[model samples]
Target: MGSIDSYIFRTTLTSFAVVMASLTGVIWITQALRGIDLMTSQGQTILTFLGLTGLAVPVLILVIAPIALMIAVAHTLNRLATDSEIIVMNAAGLSPLRLFRPFVYATLVVSAIVILIGAYIAPDGLRRIARWDSEITADVLANVLQPGRFAQLEQNLTIRVRERQPGGLLVGVFIDDRRDPNDRVSIIADHGTVLKNSEGSFLVLEDGHLERFQAGQQEPALVAFSRYAFDMSKFSRARDVAYGIREHYLWELMWPDPNDPLLKQLPTQFRSEMHDRLLAPIYPFFFAAVTFAFLGLARTTRQSRNFSMIGAVLCAFVVRLAGFALSVIANQTPYVAGLQYLLLVIAIAVSVWLIRRNVVIEPPARLVDALNALTASLSRLVRRPMPA
Candidate 1:
């Protein structure tokens, strides 16, 4: 590569990295906030909370890479134009296609990243998260029982612990069971530990007393025992991990097992996900073409570049939104999936044709005039004096 090509490639990739990290961090923080219950309610440590939340980063990158590439391309092109470098290159007989070569290289790199994450890493992260969530649900004693908080294990059943010590020791354990209408039972234990075996989960209480208040009788029965087992198997959730279509690997989606239950139930969803993953890498190329078509030309300072930038961004937005809408519609109408590919093809083809022919894209004159008039009216309203 030549010096100019190297410079453009490096600048665009650097910009892409910065934009990608910034956007991912902001979005990931919002997503992580939703899972704060893992720490606050479940009594998990901060490290565990972050580890579970960080698993979502690969998925976020899959969505953000194409947009970042477009932004980086636009920034590099605008910078070159602002410095009159594009004009100088054009004067030196550099064609639009030659100038776009560096952007294509950068886009390819971003596309590879998207492909890698979408195919394997993102799906694996989702699967791991699902498995971890299932484990947490099945281990009800550790997750649901919080120190000093009365945890409602089920309707009409409550349990509380005064304190939870290290190595899963519970102090001052109390349980109230009103599940049976005929007899209300309450048990107070000095201390207990959760025991899970092949049979089921049991709370082995030591030095506890059980009181049974019969509904028909006036006197209640009290019994004290040195050791008692409270069956807690019902509180544990199902351990079977049911992964969704988005959690499956790319190859699994491409050729799904005919006997798979999820596939048998939602065939269209499998098809939609397969197409979405297949098309993930191509978006960066389409975005780069669209951005270059609008802002790649060498324009003088007298001409407004802001409109071109806006047009490029709007076009990218429309294309991505259309693709997403098509993918969703494909879940119901299988035939709609093909439109995603067609949209990308048409958009990229048109963009490349414009670039080759040096056709500068601009908003319609009427729209620009209307916006200017609206701005003037708003300015006048703001500047008008208040009536006393």
Candidate 2:
């Protein structure tokens, strides 16, 4: 009995590891490709990119782990049946219930992990990613102007023909400042540099022209300049936090500040979001049960045994789509109608039924007899001589 238990555990764990690693690799590669544009725009370093990717792994694992486990278990059981190991176990008085112990243990371990990630780790990682993005955006905006391009710095200022010298000094600067709602000012220079002057940072233009347009004047007044300075520090400190649902944790979602502009008008959306995040962890357990149960519809060794695997995948898609649709509907409605709770209850009931049905039942004898007869007919047909 000890040997059998050990063998089952080892085989199942091996399968689990293979499936997890492969799925994680595939998901990571896809995410990395999708994020390339954002990464480049942020001027992210290789180390930063790698760190973000690493942090994403835990979230992916939490989401995909159950599906991986289901696939691994189904594949392993199929192999066992094909090799006649299950038949041998049956002959040795190993009941189906006894054989399911390892899987149950595995499911418990996976469920705990899923709970941890969904509740804590994922939220923390999300916060960090948001902060990193804010920082990168600040950096990009600070140095947005470039050479041979008319860079529009906000709505009021336009810079044309900007260049930087070897000493890190910028030259050939042109600035059009229309920032004043009542008056418009435009400055151009043959040679100028951006400097951190006493009054914040300033662009000191040399040998330039200044044009001021008064509100009532049809013609703009033009003035020549020897040296003119404009403040260069247009980019302000980053106000990183947003009042969006994605930025908050579970508790924050439930008890969001009424003072927050985002939550000031609509509280129902926040409540629905909280429910959705809280319920995400339950999906893995549901998937595990569904996969195990559906796999038992046919003998594990049946060549058409992939039906359950396909069903499991479909189940995942349907659940995701349903959740999305529910969230949208919840946002539109004014009250919390217990729809999420109802789904949870239905999922639990279905999962329980699947597990119980799969664990205790055996494939029908009539089906087996039919399969045997079909196999015999196919065998003779293959061996028969071809018609000349």
Candidate 3:
């Protein structure tokens, strides 16, 4: 490659990297802060929260890369234009397409990275987070029975144990089952082990006495046994309590069982989530296109350039918001599914326009001049006049 080609390539690549990193840090920090409350409620540690939240960085980058690219491209070209660098290159007969070849290469590399993240890395991280939540819930529920205290497992069932250990072993275990009006059963065990089998989970007791009470009789009947078993599987279901849609993956969400009472009937969110995953990989391309638009409009002042970059970013976000709103509305009407493709096409058109208009040393002078005049007029209206 020639010196000018190498120089433009290096400058644009450096700008893209710096911009992407800064935005990723900002987005991750903001999301982590907002999610801290939910994490705490789930008993997730700070490290786990950070790691789980960090998984979302790839998705964020996928969204933000195009914006950064647009800003960087705009800034790089604008600076070159302001310094008369573009004029030098143009005078030497360097075409705009030739100059943008390196940039196109740079954008393709970024797009590939975004695709890998959205498709594989992001999904894997989300799955890990769901599993972590499942394990934590199980641990909390299994530890519900405390030593030396009468802990009520349910409205009619009270359990008191002197000591508890791993492998479902319990010492001085007592269960008071008042589940029936006609008959009541009380059991005390010297030593017990929780056993999970096909019949369901049960606590096998050793050196225990079982007492049965009948509604018609005043006295209770007691029977002693060397080993007795008490069913404990009913408590196991509580450990599997899922928070909501966030707990399941695409497949799990789609074919949920008819008997799964906890699963809400909102199939829209699941469909939306599936669409979101499929659509996430393409966001980088849109961002890149938008970046081109921003870069196409160049200015002399750094502050002015910053303002322009912010404006482009905001506009992109507005487009995203509109698409999301449309997706929600579409769930109510099946015909709205077409809007997703419409959003994608719009993004592609914007990118193409940005490239076509800004690929050269600068965009057409008349268009730039008109935008400047409009902006100046808008600024004047918003500005307060000084007292005469």
Show how many residue pairs clash in every candidate, following the order shown. 0, 1, 4
lDDT of 1 at 278: 92
lDDT of 2 by residue, 29-66 (tens): 99988777544543345787887677778778866787
Better of 1 and 3 by lDDT: 1
Model 2 lDDT at residue 88: 82
Model 3, residue 272: what's the lDDT? Answer: 62
User: Which of candidates 1 and 2 reaches a greater TM-score?
Assistant: 1
- lDDT top scorer: 1
Q: Taking the tens digit of each residue's C-alpha lDDT, what string does model 1 give over 1-388?
A: 9999999999999999999999999999999999998876676678878988999999999899998998999999989998999999999999998999999999999999998899999999999999988877777777888889899988989999998776668889999999999989999999999898998889999998999999999988999989999999887756888889989999999989999899999999899999999999999999999999999987788778888888888899999999999988999999999999999999999999999998877778898899999999999999999999
lDDT of 1 at 43: 62
Q: Ten consecutive residues with minimal summed lDDT in candidate 2?
A: 296-305
Model 3: per-residue lDDT, tens digit, 1-388?
Answer: 7777678768887998998899889888998898785443443456877777887676677677766776677767777877877657756766554666667666777777766665566656666666665554454324566667787888988988887655446789898999997889999989887676678777788998989999999999999999987877777543443445544444554566656544556666656655665566566566655655565433344324554566567767887888788778866765676788788888778667655555323435696789899999999988968789
**Ten contiguous residues with the weakest lDDT in model 1:** 39-48
Q: How displaced is residue 50 in candidate 1, in Å?
A: 1.4
